[model samples]
Target chain A: MHPLVLQYDGDSEEKISKIMTEEIIIAGFGGQGVLSMGKILAYSAIMQDQEVSWMPSYGPEMRGGTANVTVILSSERISSPIINTFDTAIILNQQSLDKFENSVKPGGVLIYDGNGISRHPERRDINIYRIDAASEAAKLGSAKAVNMIVLGGYLKVKPLVELQNVVKGLAESLPQRHHSLIPMNEKAIKRGMEIVNTVHEVG
Target chain B: MKELKLMKGNEAIAEAAIRAGADAYFGYPITPQSEVLEYLMAERPHERTGMIVLQAESEIAAINMVYGGAACGRKVMTSSSSPGISLKQEGLSYIAGSELPCLVVNVVRGGPGLGTIQPAQSDYFQAVKGGGHGDYRLIVLAPASVQEMADFVDLGFELAFRYRNPAMILTDGALGQMMEKVWLKEPKPRMTEYPEWATTGKTPDRERNIITSLELDSGRQEKFNLKLQAKYREMEEKEVRYETIECEDAEYLLVAYGTSARICQKSVQVARENGIKVGLLRPMTLFPFPKKILREMAPKLKGILSVEMSTGQMVEDVMLAVNGLVEVEHYGRMGGIIPAPDEIVSVLEEKFIKQNYYG
Candidate 1:
């Protein structure tokens, strides 16, 4: 059995569950796995018996343009998937940073990859963290795992869902052929956790 | 029991259709709803249960194909977005006139013609008020969640067959595109037997069944119209489905369906937090419209507000249901726009709470 499968059974009833609602937006270029990152988070939330909604920006906007997704995870039943404001914004590029930085609610968190951001986040009311996810994934010898790295940085800060549940979620999201890459993705996540730097903390 | 899968609403509809023992799916591709066809084709349900999945060249052709399949007493379905659904209006009217049992899903986008591909409930009038020519009605099921998207396929089919009337899954682009954990039902085998009324190569021992809407005789056609009216009345009595949240103590009521209903649900929570006695009345079946509940609730509420993605289509129904027993107002975002929860709360405050509005 996978480690996550074991964790899934053990954590239920034995562990004290926290009830929190987090509305997050993941934004980047079209092929940067922004949607996938949101999907993975949503699936992880589901594994923890949390209610989640994942809404992606689709149609022509997905043709080599900015791609984004809104994910709301809650202990209670989620009301709506479409939200204008977000508790956290995981920005992958400068364009996404410019578009979504102001949309983050005050006293919330903003995590961004420093790869393409020319201007740092200017919000003083929210907590901001910068992670070199691209470099971390490149160092891990798997450039495609940038999303996993960013996701790791997210979990490190919020820790809304358990890491093992995320691994189970990854297994569910990825096809059977890509299951071999789970270990690499796990390493990328750990690297992300290690390298993330907090730029500002909310008081 | 099958484990829950994180699936898109459109994909859920496709999977649910197969599990509901749908015999065939003939649909054309459209934004926000193309996933329904794509998932069915990729899964090759044809091999899974001998269910025929065909990608028709056009929406018109798809609806005609559905008509053909339903005529032969097969469980058939088709899905499309707003403009594509418009193309099937003629076929929809004919199906209603002929009293065919089939499912038509309209994952609506913003449109008077070719509009934006985002979510909109602008097609409420089109769905409930008879878009095609002649007087007819479809059992319209509006899903607020991805789970309902999966569940309603079976329910829609059940209702369709029970009444021998066409049923529609009226959803918007947002609900179709959004993803959630869906607990899929066990697969049911494809329907092998149809009703005796089905025209499946009638034998010499039995009289041939002719499936059509062509009653040229004026008296007979009027009688058929009367029969349809009686059937609709029966449906209104039996098929009215809705959900009320915090309505028992509410002084203000929000009438909404589909995606707008989901947003209004959040608004209900927000309004309650602000010490406002607001509630949400979500109609699960739009055609039946939940008029009886609205009529009963109207006397106790200060006012009713109909929130929609379109420009006041369902508000008309709300007003008709309330029938001046309560003050009714409409707040809407048109042309692919969706109103936020706070926006709805503000609208509620400005329109109802502040004015101390009462009917």
Candidate 2:
């Protein structure tokens, strides 16, 4: 059996029918794998038969190497691929944190890697979580796995997509020769979920 | 079951072209739409379906290549962004005059010159009003989602061949770059029979079919022009594709298309939630303009806000269609800045709901 196929409940169709639409914004520097993170999430949504739309900021605005992607996972059909606010925000760098901190809905979730955030999100209505994904990835001896760790933290917070689908998504994204790395990446996801700390909780 | 995949709008168009049994693709790379060419190159459709994908020397060259393939009764296509599309205007005019069946996808960006690479509907006039020099009409299809981007390739071909005219998929940089789920059509086999007008090799059984835009006799040229006009009128009668959302009991209408239409859909949700009765009319075929529907619904509408990512171009067409039955107003945000759904709602309030200033 392939290690990538962790678990298969084959019950996403029944559960996802009741799941509300989740609009997410992932923002960071261009090279931080921000786009890939959103892509993985989008593919995961597809695996569960959810309607998904991934819109990225492009052209001169991204020439600063600043990148952002809006991913909408919905049980119903998505109308606008482009949106102003988000239900959840995953911020990587301080620039992104400052930019998108206010775009989260009042009762939404904000997850950030607290590596260089000078002014953290001060919102009281939304939930804030600080994930030291960079630090955790450094300790894991895989600097490139920072995105996977952050994704893991998000999954922990939401768990919208099941573990089985995520494993399947990893299998789809990674080449066959790199299938051996799936277990390692899965470990990073688990690490993200474990180390993420809640800084603020909305009542 | 249908095959669905998460694909960018540009990638969807490319894949759809291949699956639609396109004979060839000739395009130059440009921002927000370069993916169409890049995707085709990566897919290597030649290997799979004997489809030819080539990066032409220039947009002009690419369009001419499309003209050649289209004239030969092949399902050929070409794509470019705003400035590149401008470069293909001459070729487009020739293709229209020659009455060739081909697909031209323009992923529009902000432009007058080599403007911004961001998404904009500023090219509305260039597309629907005939950007070329001649008095010609190209059947224009505007796709609001990635799914439409895929579906329009097949539909564009069908419509173009039916009229023996040029058809263009007029979209913007946002829809071209954005990714969404798309159910691609099954692979279609390449053409087995050429049209009677096609410039295929002449057999002994028939006269050689000549394909040219040149008509030296002024009387004959005028007749050809009249024929083109008659064909356009038929299209206007048959091909006026649009969608009306929540207009059943609305007092005002929001008219938009493509990316703006998608945003307006959300605006409708927000505005209705706020107890504002507003609906949206999204035109899928811009050239046909859905004028009849607008005319029919005008008497009931308090006002019509034609929202676009331009300095207001489509508003003129809306006004012409309405013909003073009600007020028609133009609301737009230029420079590739996509307006938020709530922002559009505010524009409606300020423009019509607040001041009642509807043109």
Candidate 3:
């Protein structure tokens, strides 16, 4: 099945891929697999024959605190790896939202964990999608899968990559031991997708 | 040929080095330049291109490995920010005196002792006037863009081998950190053979070649120095490169390079917008020093502003280039801080405009 349609329906192929070349930032607290998630997304783009550069931010104490990664994927060779601002940012934690919300381009998407954030971003111009990714991951009996859940939510909104491509990428990239875990990750991803679909419907 | 891709300066340098047919890279992790190492590690070019990337024990070890590889006529390189490059100067001087060919990249950071890992241009004299003791010069190419950073690898290695000397790419934090579109250059054609002078294994037909700077006689050492000076003179004739912006009808010229030149480029636009006849002279090569270019520009120009990220190292070179042909002024913010474009504009306004600045 088409990955973008897994969570989002009624979208033509042409309309779904308008921003596929756009730069995105995936940022959150440490241990959220933010870097890996960005890498997979970036690799997916590269697999589609697009140019990509993935940059992970690490201070002297990256593991002890927040971490972020900037992924620039384009048809052209990417210059300057650092993103002064983002066309879209998928923020999984509150600190990340607060840290980068202002820097997002007007009307840019901000995907956040609904279970963690108590307040909606005060800005009216920006598009905000709240996914209960952590709770969904907990329901799947794997809190560590929250990142995968969030990635699914991101796939729904952007749909720059096809779901089948992501599945193939995960299969090729994951270790053998982790291959068994892909089923659960896919389930968690679907859960996150459903939450966004429901919200996009009501709004 | 027509597409623009955003890339960082450090990544560009690494991509460029790979395309330039560099066989080996040995480097220690350092800020603003870690990406160069990281990109090579992830790409793992060894499988197809036979490039070797090693994370060395220390900067000293890294440079030594470079020395060993370069001794074998292999295209080799090492990169670090500031403090780390300081540790490699001893080896650099030896390589210079031994007349070896290699490339070194110093993505500069603020410094003196464990300075912050931010951008700075304080290594101007270290790179241009020779960092290690004795009279030697490196062919230093200062890149202002990520595209240039990748393109300079081929140019740097070509010049290094041509002159049988070390070449350096002096870039900084902003360029390393910032993203801009870049088109990677086509790889250069590989040389079919090393120079007859390269150190290969000792052959039975010929005596074993010794790569050393040792000279037991004072006269021999003096002769070596004289010969080195002649090589530098030839380089001065052939290798000097600089960029001029808005200078044809400008009154004041701001001299800078690398990331500083990027800022000066912006300053020129701002100064011009504000009705100040200001322009920039950015030296792309710090060691052939571009003295002749400056000497020619100085007579036609008003006062010169030598803006740097150090406490004025390149400013001294700028002054030497002018040689009292015109009054030279300088602005500096050391310890790794980048001087603001507005501050530079203000300096041009006050020093050149209000002070009746004239050559």
**How would you encode candidate 1's per-residue C-alpha lDDT over B9-105 as one tens digit per residue?**
9999999999999999999998889999999999999888889999998999999999999999899999999999999999999999989999999
lDDT of 1: 0.90
**Fnat per model, in the order shown:** 0.47, 0.53, 0.00
In Å, candidate 1's interface RMSD is: 12.1
Ranked by TM-score, top first: 1, 2, 3
After superposing candidate 3, which stretches have Cα over 4 Å from the reference? A1-203, B1-5, B188-192, B204-207, B355-359
- Kindly list the interface RMSD, in angstroms, of each predicted candidate in the order they appear: 12.1, 14.0, 18.0
Each prediction's DockQ? 0.32, 0.32, 0.05
Question: Taking the tens digit of each residue's C-alpha lDDT, what string does model 3 give over A94-178?
Answer: 7888888887778677777767776556656677777778877777888898888998998888888877777765765576878
Would you estimate the TM-scores of all the predictions? 0.95, 0.95, 0.70
**Candidate 3 lDDT, B1-359, residue by residue in tens:** 33344456788888778778888999999997899999899879786477899999999999999998888888999999988999999999999988999999999888777787767888887898899988898999888776678778888898888898999999987778655456776655444566666687777888777888788899999999999999999988877787777777778888888877867876776687698877788788888877887788788887899988888888888898889988898898876566767789998778877775464
User: Which segments of candidate 2 are over 4 A away from where they belong?
Assistant: A1-19, A61-64, A175-177, B356-359
**Cα DockQ of the candidate 1 complex:** 0.32
lDDT of 2 at A158: 96
